[model samples]
Every structure is written in structure tokens, then in C-alpha cells.
Target: MNLETIQANARSSLGDALKSISVQGVAEHSGKAYGIVALMYHRLALCEMLADVRVDRFQVLLCKSALVRIHLMRLAASGKAAHPLTTCASQNFSFVDAITAGQLDLAVELARLTSDRHEPRSEYEDDFLLHRFMQKRLLHLHAGEDHDFQSLMDRWERIVEGEHAPYFDVCRALLQRDGEGFHDALLAVIEERGRLFRQKDVYPEDARRTDGALFMNGLALLRLAELNGMPTQREYPNIPHFARLPVSKLPLPLDSWMRPEEGLPV
Candidate 1:
């Protein structure tokens, strides 16, 4: 089939996956449930990378993701679900994405999670620094906390992860309030990701390996720059103007059946 048909089919599969999960059943606290919910949001967010950015749909999806993550977090806190299978991308679940999508309440709720609620800490230095960077971004955006990120930046500077280092430098410049550094490093990061997308055969097969090649994390960092009162570049390579549209803090109205409190909507 055509690309559109493929995308629609993929989305439909996600819907079917959701249908398989029940809200008030044994699946409510299941790793499967959490993964599905997270994947739903993740896909929607990546879809923003498309040339036709759907700001309205983005709000709805972000709302849905935030609510489900909150529900899952509450369950985890109450010993119902054991933290709901977080990956490096979902360490804090929906907070950074909520910020990128401009969901204030969701960002607040995500911040309240046991200091980001990221489980199974990484032994590698890069992961540790990234986690710290995410925390710094969250705090900087939400509470306007001018945290001292010099230490983290220095540590990231010392690491040698090629192509990914520019991203770290972008974060460093952001936390350090270096607009020129932010601009320069951000361009490198964006182009590097663009290069990888052009040569994705060597890359992992997941969300980043999609059609639009939209850099959601890079977008998030741009949003952080805006939030920090820094002048941001109007555009970047491999990043879309559509994905940069300002989204609403309020998510669209979810169907009653989609409510997490009632369980998986299945």
C-alpha cells in the first residue's frame, strides 16, 4: 500500500492494541498496558515531525498520554503497577513531551513524580548525564530554576559519543544560557540527526526511524530555549516548522471510554 495507508494501518494497530487492554482488569497494571499507552503518545509525538503538523491532534494525544501516565504513576505509587516500564525516552514518561506540547498541568504532575520517576538507573556516564540534563530542563521550564548545570555539561563534554555530543552541547549551552553556543550546537545536532536519517540502515529500528524524520527531542530543547527567555532560531535543519507550532496547554477532550481512572478503555 501507499505511505498514507501504511501510516493509517499502523495507527489502527495501535487502536487495536488499546482495545486489548482493559481498565479495571488484570491488565490495568500490566506492563503491556503501560507500553501501549506510552507507544500511543510516542507515535503521536513523532507524527508531529511530519510536514503537516497537526497541532489540534497533538493536544488531544498529549492530553491522553499525560492522563494515562499520571494514572499509571498513581498506581505505581500505590503499589498497583511497578512503575510501568520506562525506557530512556520515557524516564519521566510525559513531562518533557508535555512541555514540548505545552501541557502545563501535565508537566506539573510529571514533575511531582519521584524526581522524574525514572527507574533502573544507567551505569554508563552518558545516560546519567542525560537524565540529569532532562531534570535540569524540566526544572528550568516549569519552575524557572536556574540550576547550576556546569558540572553536568562538563561531564557531557568529557564523554565521546560522536554525533550525539552536539546534542549534549546544545543542552549545555541551553543550561548555561549561551545563545550563540545554543544556536551553533543545535545546528550540529539537527544536521547530525538529519544525516543519520539519511543513512538509517545503521540505526536502531524504532520511533526515530520514521518517515518525517522530525527530531522531537530537538524540538523539546527549542521549546526549553523559548521558555528560558532565550532568543531561539526561527528554524533548524531536519526540524519542521509545522512541528514548531505553539500547542495548547489544555489537551483536547478525550472520549469517556478513554478515561484512565476507569481502566484501559477496552
Candidate 2:
């Protein structure tokens, strides 16, 4: 199949997955419903990173993945009040807090229990292929100029006959241009993706565990960029600068600082 064909298949698979997840059921089982959301979020982040290379439009892929995640999470949250699968009213389940607290291991376990017993075979296969394609693209981006861009594209084509490695090695080579700038671009891309996630309401407000993970992971990547001196600003534009110039160099007393006329000619 060609790149378009593969993307179409992936999109169709995600659509089907959304259709299978009932909103009422999802709301009732919010705790368990979030596993898929977390996974899809991770996939979207990957797509955004790979999108910088651009053989095809990674934005489209990211959108499709995000759509599926939102639908599933909404469906789960909608079912919360009506479903009686588990009625422990006294117990509080905060999905967002759990994730932020680094409870993914538990989240996964719950997700397994809540996931559809009869998995859609085609969707499963499609998900696997999507992940594999993303991983391959990532490897290519990381490979840089050791292999010529054309040669890398050719190799990628051989690995997946129908697909292309978006921009080949262009982005990889550019990373060397100004590491900080590249890192900043990456952060900007991630922030853009995060906005999309919020707009779609893909995750339950109470279950923002995935959001925390994304932030933490992004931080780690920025740190790596810094360690390599890849370019701190490029790597972490979302992170504020600790060395920002203060409004004034003078260490004025708090009372003086607060008084509008204290340091100004009245």
C-alpha cells in the first residue's frame, strides 16, 4: 500500500475504535476508560515529533489519533452517573491526579479490566502498524547525515513499501544547525499539540494523568538537549528562563517596590 493508503487505513481503524466505545459506558468506567486515552495521547505526541520530517502530513495523523482519544474519553465520562458496574460512591477516583502522581502502572491495570473484551481485530492490527511506522520514522530522524537523506528515504521505503519518511533527514541535519533553536521548535510543536488535545477534550478533567506524563517527558527531552548542548532554547521553549532580566536591578525593599512613587520622580 502507499503512504496515503496506510494513513487512510489508520484513520478508518481509529474511527471504528471510537464507534465501538459507548459514551455512557465510558463515563461510568472513567478509571478504566483512560488507558486508551493515555496511549492515544502518547501516539499523538510521537506523530507531532515525526511531523517535523514530513514525507506526508503528520498533522493529519495526529488529528486522527487525537479524535479517537477524545471520543473514547468523552464516552467514558458520560456514563459515570448512570452505570452501576461499580458503585462505590464514597471512593473518589481522580484520573488526572493519579496520572500526575505517576500511577500509570495502576492506570494500565485498570484499563485492562475496563477495555472491551472483544477487541476489534483490524483495529488492533492497525494500531500495531501505526506504532511500528512511527518508531521507524523516529529512528530515521535520529540517524541524521550518517546516511544520506535520499539513501535513508530509500531504506525507509523498503521497510514500508507504501510509506515515505516525511522529510527524510532534513530535520535531523537541521538539529545540528542550532541545537537550542531546534529544541525550542520541538517544544513549540508539543505545546501546539497540547492545545489541540485540550480543544478536543480528549481526556477527562479529573484524569489528567496523561497530561502530567507528557509534561514530564517533554522536560526530560529538553534536559537531554541541554546535556548535549543541542540548544537549550531550541529544546525547551516552553520552559521559562531562570535568567530573565528583572524589572529593576536595584534590590529595593518590598514596601518601596510596592509603592508606585517610591522609586519614581513624583
Candidate 3:
């Protein structure tokens, strides 16, 4: 579906979910009632944020993290058992959107898979793979920037040494591949890292910084790719439209009106 359709669907679904949970008498103690409602409200806010197609990957990661927390809160309200509200909220999430736009489903699934079980091995593996992907994308996008290149690679190596080896291996494979367009390669990496963030709450701040760095670096790569005769997707041409000009431009500096200090020649 197009962005508009997706956003509208998300909005309607979120509104309905909020209304359903607004049942009266659900709140007994005044303080507990406020707390429960506040939690639900927080979930609704996350849903709204997720619905906005313009949200960047970093924002999506944050929203999904909040959603997971909200799910846990719902579980608590249900006496530590899975509740229908939780299921409904989860169902509202569009996995396709998560995959294509956010890559958050991976993190969400990982969190769920490990919640009650000991899956440290699998978790570490996923973390390594994510770190590698981020590194590859950074390198490709910032091919000649030695400092950025080394920094990204260093981070990946550290993650590999840490608890995310499998993730590192996966990233290594992708990076080793050739012939992918810079944009395509970068987007793929973004999708994967998005998934990682969704699964593990690994370095929210660092992930955000990395994402921003990649975007700025990608813009530079796109320009360089064009300069190197690489084909790029055609963007719509800007069309000029009639509009009133500003009443006037800002006044030029008074220094321009003043004559220069007396010189030897006129």
C-alpha cells in the first residue's frame, strides 16, 4: 500500500484500540487507575508515531521500544499473563511496514523469543550480524572517508567480540558482495539494523547517531555515484508555481552605502 493508505489505516486502528480500552469501572483505586490509563495512553502515542510514514528509522526504533514496554505493562495488568489487549495491539502492527520502513519487527520478535527463555546465543548472533551490516553500509556510503570508515569498522569488530557474533558473520557476507548500487546496499543495511534495534535495545543513542551519520554519508555517496557515471533513479522534476514575492528583501548592510575610508586615490 502507498504511504497515505498505510498512515490512514494505522490511525483508524489506533483510535479504535484506544476507545476499546477506555471502559469504565476498569479503574478501582484512583492512583492505580491513573497509572493504568497513562500506560495505555503511552501505547497510543507510540502507535501514532509508528503510523506516521515520515518518521525516520531512529524514531521508529524508539517507538517500537516503547511499544514493547507497553506490552509488558499490559501483561502486568493482566496479572502477568498474556492479555487480549496485548494481542490486539500486537496484531495492529503491520509487519510488512515494519520490514520495509522500520525493520523493528526483528527486534520485537527477538525480545519476545527471549523473554521467557535463555537465548543468549541467538541474541548475540543477531547482534553481530546487525553490527556488520551497519559497518558495511557505512563503508560503502563513505568509501573515501578513512576516519568514518575506521570508526564504523571498529564498532563492528567490537560487537563481534562482544555478544553478537552471528550478526557479525551475516554482515560480513553482505559487505563482501559486489555490484550492488550504493543506495540499494545502504537501504538493505538500514533495514537489517532496524530489525536489530527492534530485537535488542542495543545502544539506542549510538544507533540513532549511526543512522544519522549514514544518511548524511549517503547523500554524499549519491552525489559521488552520479559523478562516477552510476545510474540513479529519476526523481520528479520540480515545477515552478506562481506566488507573490516577499514584500521586500532584507535591507543591505549600511556598510555598503558608506564609502570606503579615504585612500590615496579617489
RMSD of each: 4.7, 18.3, 18.7
Off by over 4 Å in 3: 24-61, 64-68, 71-74, 83-266
Q: What TM-scores do the predictions have? A: 0.75, 0.28, 0.27
Could you give candidate 1's per-residue lDDT for residues 12-67 as a string of tens digits?
Answer: 75566566555443444464565566556656545533524656565555556666
Instruction: TM-score winner between 2 and 3, please give it.
Output: 2
Model 2 alpha-carbon miss at residue 212, Å: 6.1
Full-model lDDT, candidate 3: 0.34
Q: Between candidates 1 and 3, which one is better according to lDDT?
A: 1
User: In candidate 1, where is summed lDDT lowest over 10 consecutive residues?
Assistant: 257-266
- Residue 174 deviation, candidate 1, in Å? 0.8
Model 2 TM-score on a 0 to 1 scale: 0.28
Residue 196 lDDT, candidate 1, scale 0-100: 71
Q: What is the lDDT of residue 128 in candidate 3?
A: 35
Model 1 TM-score is 0.75
Off by over 4 Å in 2: 1-177, 207-214, 234-266
Return model 1's CA RMSD, one decimal: 4.7
